[model samples]
Target: MTDNQGAWTLGCYGNPDIRTPNINQMAAEGIRFTHALSSNPVCSPTRATFLTGLIPSQHGVHSFLDPKYMMGPEAYNTLQEFTSLGEVLHAAGYTCGLSGKWHLGANMTPSEGFTTWTTKPDGSTQEFYDQKVIENGQMRVEAGYTTDFWTRKGIEFIQACKERPFFLFLAYNGPYSLGKLMLNEARNRHAAFYADKPLHSFPRDAMHPWQHDNKAFHNTDAARRRMASEVSGVDDGVGEILTALKANGLDDNTLVVYASDQGWMGGQNGMWGMGDHFRPIGAHELMMQIPFIFRQPGAIPPGQTCDALVSNYDFMPSVLAHLGLGDKMPQQPKSPGRDFSPALRGQPLAGWDNTVFYEMETTRAIRTERWKYVARIPSGPTELYDMQADPQERFNLFGQPGTEETTTDLSKELEAFFDEYADPKYDIWHGGGSKAKRHAP
Candidate 1:
């Protein structure tokens, strides 16, 4: 999994300029999901959902975890109360390992049943080269690039655990183009190739009116090149991972999933970063859509693309069912995810729901096949868009003549869904607190 990368940045996703041969090939050799979305739009909350199959309200992580509480004395495991993907897989006799960002908290040591851990000490990245990493329960500044470091550790874990059933969460913290890191040109191996390229993939639109962060580097040439270089760097790591799997003779049996924790915006709709970059914490399509690819020879058919609407919360359940561990899914908390394992095997889902939802602190949204509704807690700036007629979302239909019924229906559905799944202790709409920091109004 990658950090802050949208599917739009890859070649298979229709970016003509970016060199993502490995990822594109992976999509060709497996199942690619065109409508895979993140339940939340930040790092920690969405990562929690991906692992626990629970939304922010159920998992209690509303936003990116603070560095102070991620390590040191205050550090605590954020997902301790839930049965996470690692825990379930480990319980099923799989050797679980994690490499790269563990922004869920307690970065000082492994959590959620992972035995082999190599991760960054903090969630945010100020620099890629020579960053602080925790390996073997010891902190040290890695001499090489952090992306490569994670990839090497992942490959090593694979080689070491190849004899047994293993589950390696190779989380890459790359293409994170939102902070001081974007101010400087990329210094990785892909730097020279991107230095002069226009990289039209990253838009140079006027700044979004609600954009409040990373203002200076929003549309700069240097930022675009840096973003492109980092994406290509991640692509290089993907190539290495695939080669290692094949070289170790573990490609056919192992299920390799390529995805991002959440989506990112590269000047889309004039927005420059993630959902939190907007003042009201937007839930635009570009901020929710992520690249989701699943590969396993003789299991999932190759060159198939599924456009079924799915969310990150659906991942854990699907993988568990696919691995014949459907009986192990947590039943007490009742995860709001359905098993999409049929779609993974290139089979048609008879009654797959065509809807997904999102939440970011005070903001909540519901998206269907033809419409999108965004609502804020205890306020009046709700929005309704006819996605089929206005895909750009340039016009608002809320309070308009023909949209009242649609708006009412969607609003009630959104509330009902959350009311059924949200834990009252962590439900922000009910005046509950979050485990991590929040961007609440």
Candidate 2:
């Protein structure tokens, strides 16, 4: 999984410029979901949901973890209280390994039942070269590019454990596509390819009114090139990993799930970064929609695209069901995700609700087939968008004459859903604290 990327950044997703042929090939040879979205719009929270199948409220991680609390005396595993994908798989007799960006905290040592861990010291990246990484409980700066290091480590782990059933969380931190780190010229091999071309894929529109972060780099040519370069670099890594899998004769049976932790906006809606870059925080489609592809050669049908609404929250349940480990799914703190494995095999999902919910701190949203309702805790600034007519979210229909009924219905459903799943101790709407840094107003 990539740090910050949009499905629109790949050629298979209709991106005209970005060089992501390897990922595009995965789309061509697998089941791609057009409406798969992240449950949260930020990094750490979404990653947490992807691993545990829990929302931010239930898991207690509402924002990106602070670096100061990631290691040394203060360091603690954020997901210690709950069971994660690695732990579940490990218990099912699979050797689990993580190759990059284990940003859930306690970075200095392996946590969550992962036997082989080589990860970054923190979540954010300032440089791709000579960066600090923690491997086998030791921290050191890598001499080569960070993306390649992770890729190489992932291949090595697969090779070493191919004799047994193994699960590799090959998390790539590249194509981060935000922060001060992107202002510098990309040092990867793909840098030269994008240096000359005008990357029209990254819109250079006027900044949005709510965009309060990463203002300096918005609409700049250097930043655009850097984003494209990093994305292509990740694509290169994907190619290498795929080749390694086939070379080891694990390609046919191994399920290759390609996805990003969350979505990123590169000047979309005139916003430069994610939902947190805004004052009230935005849940625009670009910030929520992600590339979700699954390939297992014989299991999933090739070249099939499903528009059934799905979220990162559903990933754990779906994978568990796919692996025939449905009986092993956590029951204590029930995950809201439903099994969408039927869709993977080109079969219709019976009783599947075509709706997905999103939460980021005080902001919460519900999206159905035709409408999107966004509600904020405490007082005001709620929004309702007619997704069918205005998918770009150009106008807010909240309190508008004809939208009142739709808004009210959506609001009630949103409330009821959260009421069922949200843990009161971590639900911001109920005055609860988050595990990570809170962005509540």
Candidate 3:
């Protein structure tokens, strides 16, 4: 996954501005989810949701794992609460290796059934190339471009386990940094690619909450260029991995899936670098909606696109079905996500709901194909937008005479959807008012 990244508005999805040949090639050779969303719009929470087919509330990874959010090692619930992709697949005899960005805590040691583990500490980047990675619980600084390094490790794992099925969670830490600084090698290659590109024009009332976070905060011309450069570096890494897959004759058999954690606010809404859940910006569609591509050669049809709504949580169940281990998942509460395999096959499953739900901290929002409603607790300054018209969410139509019925209905659905989790804290209406303090497990 391209952690802290976006693919929707990129050249791969529709935008012709950005050049991502490898990402575009992946889509051309496989299926792309047009309406895919990160369950939670933060790194760790969304990553946790990717591993466990549950939202942040269920998985107990409410935000990025760090001192600002979690207190200690025991605070992370990745091990105790839900089944992880690694655990389930590893148990099923599939070799599972996680190479980068284990933001769910316990970074040094293997957890969640990953026998082959390597990652760095939370929120520490000693520069993109020179960052320290913990390999098999051993700490060492890795040299060279980080994006390339992870891909190299991924190739090694693939080569080592060529005789068997393996799940390689290659989370690229590039294309997501928060500053103009980049590894010299990566910067040299990408520094001038976007020199002629224009700066993003922001909305008049756009939310620019932080000025110091320049990398993505204001998204100046320099920032955008750097962001694009980083993306190119990641693209090169992907191309390398793809090359290795083909060279090892694992291209057709291996389902190469690529996605990212969440979209950054790079110059959008006059904000940069912050995820949508950050205050004032609320849960914007740009922040939650991410680029999701799945490539399986003859398995998944090529050059196809699925617009049906899917989330990071849907990946686990889908993978289970793909591996013929669907029934192995312990029966618990009904899963929040559907097996989108049908969508991948261009077969529309029954009851295809194209609605999207988003939540972070005290904010909750529901977005339909044409409309979106955002409310933040007791006093949120509710927001409603006709997405068909105000795709940018520039205009708010909440409390307007014509929106009363739709607003009421969507509000109820949003509240009920949250209530289905059985956790009052996320109920959107009653959760915050519960007698017991609302804290994730």
Candidate 4:
């Protein structure tokens, strides 16, 4: 979840058929959001939204921005501008710690409220690599698997602040291997487990034509296997963190959250990765829908599921509400996301709108309880699908007869949503650099 590295291939939610036990166990014990999504489809934008509880338009981080954008005058001042969730928690008398990928700004130090911090440099491999920690304005490097290292740092923070409440953001970069070593391991495992069936056969209910393209994966059965293995590895890491929390006696009071930055395509739509929306071999559920689970024992009932639509943008506000500091937090002027803590507790969310808005560069989508509207900007060719009927989003019903009223209504909703929530300046700036300019009408 740290980097925009291998999001698509790792099955950010879960390959139900592939059966990741760790993820499955978590789903069984906690709530699983089937309609959760990131505010943006890429790395930096999504991270920014989660940290600040604002939309990308409000944050002016429509895409990945490097140090130049972070520091330069014309580039956009990301640092020293937006308030982070860490800062909010720190303000409310909670010690904060962050471990894992910090792609928001180049510097690893807590830029917000992390009393303790450890992070890997951007573009690093997903292996257990050396980490650079920033403590009291000082930097130090240590060696370990990235996931394990983050968990260790988090446990240390919990021990150090046993009396005082704390907030730990343990992000991981797993199941997203760039090289073939991990991929081969996954493939071998799959071959051994599912050797009787053809590895690349399309799912029976596959809605997208691209899902059947064997040539897209070409020679990547090993890659698929590796992806599955890495996901299992991440699940193991999550289990370890959960065990540590319970062992430390913090599980009862502490709120634990598990989610991915975004979904990955992973050869499900004839594509191996994400961030290629222009060519868009796949942006179906496999590439966008993410898995979100929160466990706050006693506070949030065990084994509860809420279908209320949510996204990363709601993360900060939700956390602030959980800490009883929602009143003190500054109102996010441009964020449409509301706190979902009540809904998570199995209480009916009165007036709760079940719509999640999503955008990635020129691509924009609005998912309601039953319908989905997706548009690729600059060309204005929109896609409309009834999720209840076709969750895969294969059939485009724009300009079709008898559905004109539905299309008009949804398009109007999307337009108003964009007008009020979307940032035109960021769109104009970032959309020009995008490879695809076609807009969904």
lDDT of 4 at 413: 87
**Per-model TM-score versus the true fold:** 0.99, 0.99, 0.89, 0.82
Q: What is the lDDT of candidate 2?
A: 0.91
Total clashes for model 2 = 0
- After best superposition, candidate 2 residue 197: deviation in angstroms? 1.3
Query: What is candidate 4's CA lDDT for residue 367?
Result: 79
For model 1, how does the per-residue alpha-carbon lDDT over 1-441 read when each residue is reduced to its tens digit? 999999999999999888999999999999999999998889999999999889999989999998878988888999998889999999999999999998988998888989999998888888899889999999999989998999999999999999999999999888888788897989998899988998888877888798888898877888888888999999999999999999999999989999999998888778888889888788888889999999999999999999999999999999999999998998868899999999888889889899999998899999999999999978847889998899778788999998888999999999999999999999999998899877757
Summarize candidate 2's per-residue lDDT along 1-441 as a digit string, tens digits. Answer: 999898889898889999999999999999999999999988899999999999999999999998877887888999999999999999999999999998888998888989999999999988899999999889999999999999999999999998999999999998898778788999999988898988888887888998888898778988889989999999999999999999999998899999999988988778877888888888899899899999989999899999999999999999999999988889869899889999999999898898999999889999999999999877758999988899989899898898778888999999999999999999899888898997758
Q: In model 1, what is the error at residue 342, expressed in angstroms?
A: 0.4
Local error of candidate 2 at residue 134 (angstroms): 0.6
Over 340-400, each residue of candidate 4 has an lDDT whose tens digit, in order, gives 8786677877898888787765567777888887776577556788888887666777777
Off by over 4 Å in 3: 67-77, 124-126, 179-188, 199-219, 422-441
Q: Output the lDDT of residue 9, model 1.
A: 94
- Displacement of the residue 41 alpha carbon in candidate 1, Å: 0.7
User: Could you list the CA RMSD of all candidates, in the order they appear?
Assistant: 0.9, 0.9, 3.6, 4.8
Each prediction's total of clashing residue pairs, residues at least 3 apart in sequence or on different chains, is 0, 0, 4, 20
Look at candidate 3 and tell me the lDDT of residue 26.
Answer: 89
